[model samples]
Target chain A: MLYLIGLGLGDEKDVTLKGLEVIRSCARVYLEAYTSILTVRKETLEEFYGRELILADRETVEQEADEILRDAAVSDVALLVVGDPFGATTHSDLVLRAAKAGIQHHVIHNASIMTAVGCCGLQLYNFGETVSIVFWTDMWKPESFYDKIRRNRLSGMHTLCLLDIKVKEQSIENLMKGKKVFEPPRYMTVNQAVDQLLEIVQNRRELGEELALTENTICVGLARVGASDQKISAGTLQQLSSVDFGGPLHSLAISGCMHPLELDMLKLFAVEPSTFEQINIEDSSTYLS
Target chain B: MLYLIGLGLGDEKDVTLKGLEVIRSCARVYLEAYTSILTVRKETLEEFYGRELILADRETVEQEADEILRDAAVSDVALLVVGDPFGATTHSDLVLRAAKAGIQHHVIHNASIMTAVGCCGLQLYNFGETVSIVFWTDMWKPESFYDKIRRNRLSGMHTLCLLDIKVKEQSIENLMKGKKVFEPPRYMTVNQAVDQLLEIVQNRRELGEELALTENTICVGLARVGASDQKISAGTLQQLSSVDFGGPLHSLAISGCMHPLELDMLKLFAVEPSTFEQINIEDSSTYLS
Candidate 1:
């Protein structure tokens, strides 16, 4: 049996009791470490699960999947992923592969930033399409995600912007030199994401285009969600573009039609209560439950 | 401290180690019993945790909230929710109440259908706003949710329709008599939701109006997700309307634009492979990662 388990979005203890039990029963455990991350160290998880985990990078999980699935027909094997297995970048291909190989599999679900972002007070049902905001380079800056956010806003729906995380990636110089060296992992902070977002608005303005997003648009910055030290702040895009949200694994939500209840909740986390003066909060007190 | 812990979408074992520990440590533990449910019984959860459980129906959580938060400021208290704390319904209001009461609180996130629906081959990021389908009566057949689904489909994004569950609800007769009698729980099945959906499309057609949804629209029906006997089926809306996906807590996903990879995964659970003939699966082979 091949068990694909989710370790959730916090420390080692975030793994469910069932997931931990499966790990104990599995003959070999592999942790998929590419798409999402846990704030705790690998050693901490190892000590908690009482099993040595093999860190499966992109190559191992994508290229050497057979090795991960080997002998699964005879004994149990587990591939633990940070967040829900299919939440961030999906591992359904691997599950499909296992199905083709006639390997029985099960999925253990856990918290992903996808839904956990609602803790910041936005209603999950009100959120529109979620978009990923990648790290922009000097020569290559893509703003296609902006259009999606605009559409969501136009529909009076909230947009969740997933910040990019470049982990175990090699530099262009090293790739050209055929070096195996990897640059340090980089997680996009909400501040940098806001900067890119503001730049997009500025560029569109320069072209005399009226976009739904503006510097005064209301946005919420969330960092280290589901952790003890999790932080959430809400304000206009311009107001949050310079404010630091502390550490990594940050996400941003550009809200559209907000209910008074939502604004009331976001009000508790506002950087400046006065900045909310411009937000047009909808009156859904009669409907919001 | 007030701990709003999510018990993932399964049995008692689905609770995270952290959530379980907090429940054990809490002076009183209340389970939110209205919005969602776990397949396991309350007694099973009580036995596993070695504590007597208090079920908090809608009234207790909404009107008698002070009773729940009475001693939360001085001692630990937990409100265990079925899915991710903020996934199905916005618990932010309760959290807001706690904040106003000066009670420090913590949230333990867990798997929610909002994200877990991706397991059936849909991409989480491609999903748009979620809508709830309530059990319609002769006079109360509301189809306002149809507009939201149309908006989502217009944007070429998937829609996750959360089926409603009526637990501990009072009938009009019982209410008028003031007998305090409760109606038997009625969970909206995928078939019923589809019937209402099809009816709406028919009504719109009668009115000479166009809609993004139709009998031939592709969808996925998921039942008892995260359970050992979890079921996932995919086909055209007409094909899936009659299929039995087993017990409660079913969710339906209406697909918009599809990627080939998504089709491949959905194909494994296809009710009839021929139904895929109408789906224009996009070639995202080069970009999907």
Candidate 2:
């Protein structure tokens, strides 16, 4: 039997009771570390679980999944994932492989940013398709997510922008030379994402396309969500681009049509309470009644 | 401090260690019962947590919210919600009210069907806006969800349809007379949802509109997700409508354009192995190589 457990977004204590029980029963445990991350350190998790964890990087999981599944047919083996097991497509692929191999598998679901983004005061049902914003390299900048955000905005739905985290990445030059040296881990900040989004808006302007977002567009930046020190600030794109959210694992949300109550709730987290009134184009007073 | 904790899908054991700790520390705990429910009985949860839970129905939550929020400013209060705390907009409204009352609050996130639907072998990122399918009444049947599904399909994204569950609902006659009588709990099954969807497609056909889905369209039906007896079946709409996915809390998903890998994974759960080849319009043979 194989258990794919989710270590929910916070510290080690965020694991569900069922997940903890399964982890304790497992003969061997592997932590998939490359996709998303928990707020606590690996050592903290190890201490809490009272078991040693084998770190499964991208290469280890992608190339050596068979080894992890070898003994699962007879004994319980657990692979812990940061968020939900299926938050990333690779995990789904792993489950499929386990199924094909005739191994009994179970998934213990936990919270991921997909649902936790609701903490920003926007209703979960009102959110449209979510998009991921990757770190822009000089030559590999992509703006496809811009149109997706536009579509969501046009439909009067908020959009959740998942920030990129580059871990164990190799430079293009090193890949060509077959070098194993890896770059330092980099997590995209809300400021960096905002800058790239602004650049895309500028390019679209040059191309004579109507802008989906502007400098005064309402945006919310959340950092270290589910943690005690988690910070959420709502402001315009221009204001958010200069705001420091502190630390890694940040997310951004572009507001669409806002209900007056939603506007009232979000205003409490605004950079400046008056900024909402100054820049919000929506007639929020209509919903006050 | 007020703690809004999510009880992930399934039984009491699905609650996170952090959520459990908070519940234990709270002086008073209220379980929000009207929005959604767990597979286990309230007694099961009370036994597991060793805490007596105050059942907060829709009327209690909506009309008597102040009672729930009272004393939170000086005492620890926990409002337990099935799934994520913000899965429903009313929770957000509650949070806003808490803020207005100057109460310190925290949200403990948990797994929701929004993300757990990935257990069906579909990538979460590929899912577009989610729609809710309510039990149709003789006088009021809404087909707006059909348009939403069509939009998602046109965008090449899957659509997760959240089936409605009516608990502690008052009948129209009783409500008109201000009676205190309540109706029996009713949960919309996948079969019922598919029937309504097919009826909508038939109506569209009569209106000379091109169909976005048909009886042969691939669909997946899931019941008691995240529970031990959780069941998932992938088949054509017609086939799924006849399949019995036992118990309550069912959900449906309409397939959009499928990646070959996704199709492969979904085929493993197909009602009939040949059904995939017969109903899948996409050329999946190319993916076999």
Candidate 3:
């Protein structure tokens, strides 16, 4: 049997109890190291679960997946992921391979960042399409995510922006020269991500898209979610661009036109809470004021 | 301090290690019972975590929220919800209430059904707007979700359809008559959800909308996700509508035009795997064959 278990977003304790039981029972366990990740280290999980885990980096999975599923054809094996088993594309590939290999499999799900954003005081049902903001480079900065977010905003829906993480990624020059050199792994910070977003907005404006980061466009920034020091701040995109969220694995939410209740909640965290509370949403006058 | 913890999707063991620690330290623990739910029972979690838990039903949350958040001003409290802390709208209300009470709060994220569907061989980044499929009744069946799904499809994006869960809901007549009564909770099955989709497609066909659920429109049906008996099957909607997925908490994925890798994975699970694999997707002749 092949087992796929989710280790939720925070530290060592983020893994489900059932997942730990399976982790302990499996003779060999592999933790998928790429995709999404938990703040805890492998040693922490090892100490609590009382089992040593082999980290399966992107190379291992893309190259050695056959070996990982080979014994599953006979005995039980567990492949643990940092979030829900299917939260990333790599795990899906493993599942497809398991199906092809004809191995019976089970999945133990856990908390992932996808649903955890609701804690930032935004309605889940109100969220539009989710987009991932990747690290911008001098040669390869992409603006596709900006288009999706823009479209979602036009539809009056909340947007959940997943920040990018580069794990064991090779430098462009190293890849072209067929070298084994690696670049430092990077997790996008909320501030850097916002800077890129603002740059995209400015470019779009130059191209006549005409949308800019506005004070009333309400945005929420979360840092080190699921950790003890997880911080959530709500303000405008312009306001958020300057705040130091102070950590890795950050996510941002571009909110939609607010329901009275949602606005009330957001106001509680604003620099000027009273200003938002007095808005008479039923009339256009309040928005103009 | 208030902590919103996601229990993830399966049983009680699905709680992350971090979530468990918070639960252990919380002065008051309330499980939000309205949104999504785990397959495990309260006693099961209590036994594992060694703590008594209070169940916060819908009425208690909406009507007696004061009691739930009362002591957060002085002590640490935890509110648990199935899936992620933000998977539903009700949790947003709870977070706002905590803020209004001057209670500092943190959200511990978890995996939710929203992104977990990425396990079905769909690209997470390609999913567009998500829609909820409610269990339709004679007088209350609404079709607003159809438009949202249509909008997503038009944008060339996959749609994540969240099936409805009705727990502790009161009958319309009981509330009007001021009598205390509640209906047994119901979880919509994959079969029922697909049937509604087909109906909506038929309506669009009559209206001359270029939309329909064809025999070749690929789909994935998942049952009892994160459970030991979890099942995943991929085929056309027509074929999947007849398959017995078994058990509650099933989710469906409506695929868009596929990338080469996605097509390759989908072919592995096709009912007619050989025939599907033989086709050259870029060549019309192969599809015609």
Q: Which candidate is the best by TM-score?
A: 2
Docking quality category of candidate 2 according to DockQ thresholds: medium
Against the reference, the lDDT scores of all candidates come to 0.88, 0.85, 0.75
True contacts kept of each: 0.92, 0.82, 0.78
Q: What's chain A's TM-score in each predicted model?
A: 0.96, 0.95, 0.91
DockQ of 2: 0.72
The TM-score values for the models, in the order shown, are 0.95, 0.96, 0.88
Give the winner by DockQ. 1
Model 3, B191-269: lDDT tens digits are 8888887777777788897663444566778776666667777776666778888777888887765676666666655
> Model 2: per-residue lDDT, tens digit, A1-289?
9898988887898899999999988999999888888788889999999999999998888899898998789999999998788764347667777888999788899988888888888777778888999988888999899989998887788889999989999999999999999999899999999999999888999999977777778889999888888889998888899998988789999888787777777897999888877543443321222
DockQ of each: 0.83, 0.72, 0.57
Candidate with better lDDT, 1 vs 2: 1
| Candidate 2 runs further than 4 Å off | A88-90, A280-289, B88-90, B280-289
Tens digits of per-residue lDDT, candidate 1, B138-176, equal 999998889988977876778899998999989999899
The TM-score between candidate 2 and the true structure equals 0.96
> Runs in model 3 with CA error above 4 Å?
A169-179, A212-216, A268-289, B170-177, B212-216, B263-289
Cα lDDT tens digits for candidate 3, A229-284: 77778766666778887767789988775677676666766745544554454222
